[model samples]
Target: MRHTVERAMAAERSRYRRFWVAEHHAVPGIASGSPPVLLAALGARTSTIRIGSGGVMLPHHQPLVVAEQFLMLEALFPGRVDLGLGRSPAFTAPVRRAMRQEEDPPDRFADDLTELRDYLDGTGAVTAHPVSDRTVPMFVLATGQGLAVAARLGLPAVLGGPLLESPDLAAALAGYRRDFRPSPRAQRPVVTIALDITVADTDEQARALVLPEAWAMARSRVTGEFPPLEPVAAIVDRPWTDQTRRRVEATVRHAVAGTPRTVRRRVEELTERTGAGELLVTTSTYDRAALAASDTALARIIGG
Candidate 1:
């Protein structure tokens, strides 16, 4: 895992762009503690690449503690930390109950988000020393009503969905632009779209690589089975029929899984549709060589 992260960091540096880390702590069979450790290590290794969580599931941690941990990270890395917060519990009911018996109500997310900002700014009723007055950017990961809250606060937001055909994505971005209240940190709305990408040498290979991850995600959505990612061979051997592919494609159309030329054409279409200023790419393969090849292909696509 450490080596994979190091290679990713190296790739990011070579590409001269920022990359955010995706944390899947609750994903069964994966090492849970690797994300934070990997982020810190990447921060130390790279001189200019910005390091951040694609999002941290905020409901899983106390806001104050989260503020402190992120503050420390920002203090060490200074100018390169981003805190992307998500409201999902990121686990099953039993796991959530075990973690916090008296978890705060979900309705309190807006208030908690405000308080977290205050704590980070050192203006909360209880002061935090090192984090006060620091200028690390905070981004909210929003899919629905959370988008409205982020806009009201004038913070940048990241959304996961299809850019071209998603009415929800259009509505959320419009709401943010319309209702945004200018803060000292941001005078204008900032929107980022997270897209699932799996690039390979050919369309067939890319789709083959994506099927296992897509299948696992689909199965997990229905059943709670969180298994380690399997190879394309395993997915091809599964009983999923063409009907299943059509069903999954309805929800997974946002994913860009094909050759670099094909993926780039889709990405260009998405950019025109969303007017998003940034793109976050997420891949699900386990092999470092495959991951690097995909990222390299993406870089060429974007740069062209």
Candidate 2:
């Protein structure tokens, strides 16, 4: 995980301003379950790339804990840290119980987010240690009600890759921007769409690169177990159920995978349609090198 992030930083240093890691618990297919630890390490290694959580699942943790961790991260890296919060429930019932004995009530997210921000800014009844007045810019991993909450808080919204493919995407983003209420953190709304794309020398190669993770996503929904990604060669040889095949194809279709030229055009259309200021590329192919190469191709085409 460290090596993969470092390679990305090295290759994208001039092309991108920030690097973010995600949090997933008890998923074998994912390695980043602790964003604070990972981001701190990344912050220590690189001087310029802004390191942050793509977001921390707020429901599983206390607001004070979240504030202290990111405050320390901002202190270590100073002006190059961000705190993106999320509201995803635990994966399974048992996991949910382990994280929160009483399931998180959806209505509490606003209060939770506000308290976290206060703790970071030293406006809470108590203050965070390693004292610094600088506020770490906060963002929301927008999904479900997250977009509206972000707007109300006047924080930037990070729309997920799946949301980018939704039919209502343009309208939804417009609404978020329109309804946004200005706050001390931000006076205007900002939108950043996260997208899944793979750029290879040929369309076939790019399609092949996306198969492993897409197939894994389908298998998880069909079987209730999100398994680790498999090589495309191994996946193609295996037999599939009619149901599984349909599900797998549906997931893969959400992605834009093709030669660099095709990917560039598609991404430009998406940006124009959404009016998003930033595009967060999330290319997840099984092979690390293939994923890195996809990023390289994209950087060459549009990174400048």
Candidate 3:
């Protein structure tokens, strides 16, 4: 993954806006648990492309600590750091136990966001180390009430998952914009939609590219363990139960995968529907080379 991001993504630096890593603790399928640590490595390897978290889950850490880590990142990367925050709980009960998270933690995300911003903007009661005047632009990984929080705080929202395909998506975003209160960080509402998108030479090839991740998703649902991605041939050779097959089909159906023209058309429709200013491609495949190729094709399709 690091190799692909360092060489493949960095190679197409001009065609991509940002390369964001995610935070997933104690998930067998995910290797990187800390976004800031991974971001530091990725930041050192690439120079131009912006690096950030898809996000750092705010429920897992203190707001001041989060600010200090990203501030340290800004000190290292200068203008290339962005902080995308989320309030997702741990992946499972065991994971939550491992993180020492409360069984029924109350939502303090809005307050944490305020505290984090204060530290970043140097308005906090206590100073965070390596503080610089440059504000590391913040974005919320929003869904449902998350959107409302983003609007009230005057921050950009990074929306993904079922919300992107929700029937009420238009109304939800409309409400966000209508209720948005401009802050010093942002004078207007900004929305960035994220989803799995794959581009290949042909529609068939694109579908094939999505198989590994789709199979993984199906298996995770059944086994309660999100395992490492398998090769397409390996996935094809294995026998799948009817439920697994249904889940795999459903996942593939949700993913945007096809030739450049096909992907372009769907993307245009999504942007038109959401009025999103940015699209964050979250494509994952067992084949690293294919993933890179898809990213390249997507960059061209989006005229990046």
Candidate 4:
């Protein structure tokens, strides 16, 4: 994963805005469990690109600790650190128990967000240190309630997953803008859309490139575990249940994968629908070479 980030991102540093790592604990498919640790390493390898979390799940840790960690990151990297916060719970019941999070826990997201911001802004009762004058911008990874919280608090929002394809998407974003409050952190509303994007020579090839991720997600829904990505040939040769096939098809349909022109058109449509200022490509495939090529093609499409 580190090698992929270094090659795909650092190679074309000017093409990317931020290299955002995700936080997933005890998920067999995901290697990253700590965003801060990963961000520190990525930041050292690249100079211009922003390093941040796609996000850190706030429910898993205290607000102060989060603030201190990001602040330390800002100190190390200076003006190039971002902190994206999310309210997602642990992966499973056992993982939740392991993390000491209650099953169906009460939502403390808004409260935690407020406290964490206070520490970053040096307004909390206790200061989180290695503090500097520069601010580490915080973004909320919005789903449903998260949008409202972000709007109310005057923070930028990162929207992804099924929400991007929701019938009420425009309405949801409109509501976000309609109810948004401006703060010192942000004087205006900013929306960034996240999707799994892949580019290849042809539409079929592009779709195939995303099959491993789609397959993994499909099986995870039924098996209760997100297994490691398998090669495209291995995935295709294996027998799949009817349910798996449907789920895989659904996932593949959601991902934007095709030739450069095809991808550009889809991306433009997303921008038109969401009025998003940025696109967060979360594409993952087992073929590292193909993935890198896709990244390169995607960068070219955006004139990066």
Candidate 5:
């Protein structure tokens, strides 16, 4: 895992335009997880790449702590840091209970987010000592009604989930643009859509890689068992009865996986459909080489 991270860091230094590290816990056997160390290391190595949690689940941490941590990161990297905040716990109840503290309600997120803005701007009661008055770009990672909140605040939003499951991308973007209120920082809505993408030399190869993720996700949905990446061959070799295949297909349908050509076409179609300023790509896989290859393929497709 360390080697994979090192290679990814090296690759980011070479040519990647933007990179995001996802934050999650309860992956099979891992415990006491924290992404700050990994993110800090990546920040130190890369000169210009934009890095942040695909989202740091806001409901799990104190706003002040989050603000301070991200403020420190922005101080270290300046101008290249982003803070993407989301509301989901990113784990099941047991894990949440284990991690829960006395101040876990996080009900102050909306108010706290406002306060964080003030602190970062150097106008709040308390300020980050080392990085006082430093402002960094903040994005709210939203689904459903959270879009309205982002739109009203004129904050950029990263929309997740498939178009089929939620408000269509076109409608959501249109709504945000229509209802957007101008803030001092942004006069218009900045929209970024998140999509699951997997690419390989051939469509079949890409599909094969995605099958394990699909199967795992299906199992999670049914039993709430979040496990580490199992071998793709293992998933393929196991008998997926018709009922299981149907369940897995429902989840997989939202993802875009295929050869480079197919990925390019789908991404282009999404761009045309939503007019999104950016598209955030998320891939689920255990192979670092394949992950890097997938990112390269996406860059080519997006003409980055």
Candidate 6:
């Protein structure tokens, strides 16, 4: 845990502007189920860079609890906190039951988001202690109906590559931008697209770094479980069926990885195509040193 936080500090030192922790449940080999705990530590350790949830899965939690937690984060970090939320349901039926959340009707995401917003603004029956003071901005992680929610509520949306991968998605996002209603908190529609961006000294090195996670992704699909990342050397030596190789290739193909120039050009194209205001990047590698090295190389490319 300390190591991960330190890497975030390193990323900030390397001039990455924001750090977001995700909320996941009943997942092995992932550690971001409690965004508040992680974000608070990050808020205390780093200065200047924004710290946020990427996000709190609102369906599994109470709106007031979510409001108070993020408001407390804002209080701690002052002007450097964000409240990113997603309406994703629990990962599985068992997990949903474990959280004591109903399965049929499910949690009312839109209403919860509205209530959370009201709590943040001190306009609800329940007051969020310490008061949000309208300083902490809320961003919705969206794709389908989630996008509509963001548009209707006039909040910024954070979309992943899946939503920016095709023309239909681009068109949908354009519609979102066109029909969005501005709230007092958000004056206009803002979009941030998340991508898997990896950069290294050479194309081969960049691909090699992605191999561990990519292969694991393929292997997990076949095994019905998401496995821990393996070393690249081990992944390279695997005897794979043709279908497995194809699956692995497909998983990594969504990413843009290469030498700095190659990555930079692709990034420019991605931004132009998606019309996104910010880029949230996710890079995964088995070797910690290689990951950090890639960030350093990218830092130079971005003049960070």
Residue-level lDDT of model 6, residues 1-304, one tens digit each, is 7867988899899988888888888666567779999998988889888999898988878899988888888888899988899977776677778988775865488899999999998988878888755567899999777888899999999988566776678677877888799998688989898888888889888988888878877876676556778898888787999988998887677788999999999888987887888888888888888888888887787673
TM-score of each: 0.89, 0.94, 0.97, 0.97, 0.89, 0.94
Please identify which of the two predictions, 1 or 5, would achieve the higher lDDT against the true structure.
Answer: 1
Q: Which ranges of candidate 3 are over 4 A from the true structure?
A: 4-14
* Cα lDDT tens digits for candidate 5, 1-304: 4653665575574566666776677777332255566678778777878777767776677667777888888888888777777776656777777767333563555776677667666677877645644467778887756777777767888887854245576677778889988886577888888888998999878877777678887777667776666788788788777877897787667688998888888888876777778888777776767877787777777774
lDDT of 5: 0.73
RMSD (Å) per prediction: 2.6, 1.7, 1.3, 1.2, 2.7, 1.7
Error of 1 at 114 (Å): 0.9
Instruction: Highest lDDT: give the candidate number.
Output: 4
lDDT agreement of model 3 with the native: 0.88
Q: For candidate 4, lDDT tens digit of each residue in 118-156?
A: 999999989999777998899999997899999999999
Error of 3 at 213 (Å): 0.8
TM-score of 5: 0.89
lDDT of 4: 0.89
Best by the TM-score measure: 4
Ranking by lDDT: 4, 3, 6, 2, 1, 5
Writing each residue's lDDT as its tens digit, candidate 3 over 157-243 gives: 999999988987888899899999999878999999997999999999999999999998888777777898999999999998999
Cα misplacement distance, residue 182 of candidate 5 (Å):
2.0
lDDT of each: 0.74, 0.83, 0.88, 0.89, 0.73, 0.84
Instruction: Put down candidate 1 lDDT per residue, 139-165, tens digits, no spaces.
Output: 988877878888888898887854345
Q: Each model's number of backbone clashes? A: 0, 0, 0, 0, 0, 0
